[model samples]
Target: MTEIEFQKNFSQLQYHLYTSPLPHVSNLHPHQKTIHAFFMLDHLREELQRKNESTLKTVNAKDFNLPEELHVYHSLYPLDQRQEKSIKIFGYPSWVYKSVCSVDGRVYCLRRIEGFRLTNEIAMSTIENWRRIRHANIVSIREAFTTKAFGDHSLVFVYDYHPLSQTLFDKHFSSSSLQANNHPQSGGTGVVVPETVLWSYITQLASAIKTIHSSGLAARMIEPTKILSTNKNRIRINCCGIMDMLTFDGGKNIHHFQQEDLIHFGQLIISLACNSLSSVLNLPKSIDYISRHYSPDFKNVILYLLNKPTPTKSVDKVIAMIGPRILHEINSVHHYNDFLESELSQELENGRLVRLLCKFGFINERPEFDMDPSWSETGDRYLIKLFRDYVFHQVDENGYPVVDMAHVLMCLNKLDAGVDERIMLVSRDEQSCLIVSYKEIKNCIDSAFRDLSRRK
Candidate 1:
């Protein structure tokens, strides 16, 4: 029989045998065991063949086409007006065509191949996993299509388009001549700003990283460039690290290599924090810090072994040099202050002080303030009036509002307490500030006055 016919017949036979229940076997002679092993090999080969055939059929380029009735949602530019540009997939052996989606007008990255050796079931499982994961930080998978084009099967994974630009690394390392101070443009319409927008981008990225960690998955490849800031304060994290490295023959011992991802994440955080600090301090930009700071711990060790000088390259060192510690301390204190403020706000929202403070013009009325009711029902109008009264009339013997801790706490307490109670504080300085509501102040003062009267 020809090779093709032999393969087909062998596949058919193995499929039947493997599907059948295993025969009970006693201790067999070497020859019998060899025969059994041969059958096992045949079964495995047939299974592999089936898998390859399934993959080839699915990836056939002819099977895929743009779906009709494509709905446009959140396109950066006019879908009908934007020109479609094709990008060649460099370094990949597969023929992939990437174009902007006319329906959504987002960049649609497509991988089209004549054949693949991955099974349809495997592909389906991967897609299913992708669908289950949803986060503001993660790029949403809009749709996937498998269709035939000119007798060739094709598969496409559709993701929300994120405009690509010079990654943080590219921007930092590329030749100075290519560096222009113009607002860096990305996406189709070039409406997004990169420089003035990085703070929100960094925050969104941290939130996304937090989400990923909560999902029991480590984002292995977290670098500045891999993070894209989408419209509406959302961020898309590219290069997810949850892939099976072994499946792609990308590495050995996939489980052990996960530590590399942890180091990378730490490096990313350090870089983001340092950059933010530098910008805040109005310091000159420097790439040396980022590069030296992000060098893998193992790489630093290797350099030491090779008798090469290595910088103090660790996240801890970078954090120490930068103002992260001071920021951390301040944030912790601020968070505690916010907690106290929230408590005061809840009390005010419950109308505990409505009767006591209304005489002082500190009534609860809905105001044109941005404070959310979900955050605090003490109406913005009430807070604003209370703040103004406290600023003007409330002062201690030394001319300081009695309520002062942090901004949030100070605002809430002064609002809940009448301006008359504010006279107890010595000064606005944190050390002399007393963060207490009107009720607490009244009880303390009333008790003091009664004690004085009895002594008299």
Candidate 2:
């Protein structure tokens, strides 16, 4: 028999492998599983791409009349939505901006304390302590410096930027929450945070305070407005070193400030639980509400923190009291980690197929090789061209375009695996056809790509 005839016979045998039915592996429907997995991977990819775009995104400095540069940072984009409600937490009209660091090409959040002149260099050094203290629930202080880029003596602090993060205040206590509270049709229950989420916040805050106190610093600003809700039930303390700089004295009562941190932490929890900032103002009412709503252990923990200041009343004590609850938080974290890992694994094959498709793009329809009469549509390249049409450019019998993602995925997977399974590829004109194995097609792709690379 001729070599061409032998090849055609072998292709026919390989094609049977695909045509043959296989036993069910599991009870789960294959189509349903494939659809769910593909869609989830696509969503994750799109979200990651969006975050990446936001990170590298630059603003037109001229359009916004923004400063061309502030030391090593540039591309200043205001992170604050409402410039009208300026923050006075740092005892100055503070503005938030998202900027890119020219030195390392990293996006950072810049908290600019407007019109604040640094009289004491030691106050600048206060940020160094905060810079040293790092915790998962803290928005890490990078550096603080005074700049006149905003046409004022602005104290600008650089922090790690978390894209699409909302503050706890905005997430839970914004106009929506207020409107819900004032809704006449409903009772004044207001928007109550879930108990599990509240415990998560408590454990996280306790952990953060422990880190800060251990580093000889205090997180004086622990309110909802200063805490970022980066993800579902995930909170991080923002603007850590601002108060330290603004409230600078030559000598600080570190112990007293540490005690105050405990007080503020208690108030923060009470505020979240009551769903109102005013709840903290009336201590007895807040405690009574907590007693009525939350567990006894929660109320007791709050009472311990809100008690009179003593050297023994530290974050370590808080951690000790709520040690069992901490286990729940860590367990929740591990479960979430597993979920993300599963989601990530689903995208592994998609990434490989994307690379394979890219190779096809480079090798097929080459204008440079078009000059050569025997280039594409002649040999191995012809098979690849037909395979491309089989994979992406399919049509139904009625002449309508067929958009079958499952078919595309299956073909790509087979090609990537370089299986011995064979398929028939038809020419676009329907005048020619070829029976080829995926292994052979994969070889053709690699050969074509290599030739193109060497030519380049």
Candidate 3:
């Protein structure tokens, strides 16, 4: 039936039900109600198809198989692949067929499923909308296809293959316990990595969300598992692929993008930070120390729950207390600068002391160390070790290792040799010891190390 006629019939059915005297409409037979609901849903789908057809028609079939140069960044992964054997992955239902493709020498995932018939036009429109959106964190779509067979339909979406990256839940919650047990020294340490690394991930995640917001789209799903990172600096978000699936089934109802995205984004941040804190502090899952301390609203919710008259009052209060403490521990550097200054100073003091061979024009305006000082203690240790290895060479002094003037000048050419730029500057005459700055140190260390690694 035509969309309008179907809608009219569905509305008439709804009107009859609403006008019935029985408040509880359970008197209807189970099979009859089931059939009624099924037709109503079908009619709604038809109406949506009619409404979205014009927009979908604008999406050309040729766009799906565009040449490499003509394809957008999101379409690159899907277009370059030579289809491989089907595989099953977690998260999705078992019925969905999956394949792997090598695009630009990188593996990309392609999922094909039948039963949910999507028009080529609709698929193309979704791809087009995705192409215009750009974010550092969000994974770009590679390509999409739709096919129809005798009464059966299938849709395929191509996406960049992120190796060694799992959903946040998989990474933090599922794997952390096993990792903590197996590699107690590294992963089991109560300390998290430096704020720099954590902030790097957070900033990328926020930027991705911001991009989605700007594109007039909302990432309905924002969680750890959706956030992906390789060993490299790049982070890829898997929202577009999931959103495409939802839109294919007429589930894209984003009337309030900002509100919904913001809520989800907040939840994502809270979840990650909470999980990190729980792992590091050995706290329960529900207690989010970081959010409770940083977010007053969340804190209030916890407090209200704790105030309930129950035997678990003490336990609830303690859990509530844990969240704030985690937040405090992570963010405590904001209130005090001594810890960072001392740590940076110690790194410079221990590393090789590079004296100015000849007084070249040194700037009157010194370097700035304005970045956040609050880093996980483990991060501090890594930075220290990084300085010793790349920037400063250890020397034997009176039968003991010491960093002195000679070591500094010898390491001058090697200054900033590592990724963590922590350097030690000394005067040629060995009189002045001016710690240049942590920022300069990290830059010098990183550069020197990077160049050395590249040479090898």
lDDT of each: 0.40, 0.81, 0.44
Model 3 Cα shift for residue 279 (angstroms): 12
Mind giving the per-residue lDDT tens digits that candidate 1 earns over 148-261?
A: 542455444455544332245444322341234322222111122332233344344545555654444555546554555443334577545324311343334433333343
**How accurate locally is residue 131 in candidate 3, as Cα lDDT from 0 to 100?**
65
In candidate 2, what residue range of length 10 has the lowest lDDT sum? 10-19
Model 2, span 217-333: residue lDDT tens:
888888889999887889999889888888897436778888999998998888888877777778898788788778999999999989999767888899999999999999999
Q: Per-residue error at 98 for model 1, in Å?
A: 8.3
Of the two candidates 2 and 3, the one with more favorable TM-score, higher being better, is 2
lDDT: worst 10-residue window of model 1: 73-82
TM-score of each: 0.32, 0.87, 0.38
| lDDT score for candidate 1 against the true structure | 0.40
Pairs that clash in candidate 2: none
> Which sections of candidate 3 miss by over 4 Å?
1-107, 147-153, 175-197, 232-234, 239-241, 248-252, 276-288, 291-456
| All models, RMSD in angstroms | 28.9, 11.9, 27.1
Which is the winner by TM-score between candidate 1 and candidate 2?
Answer: 2
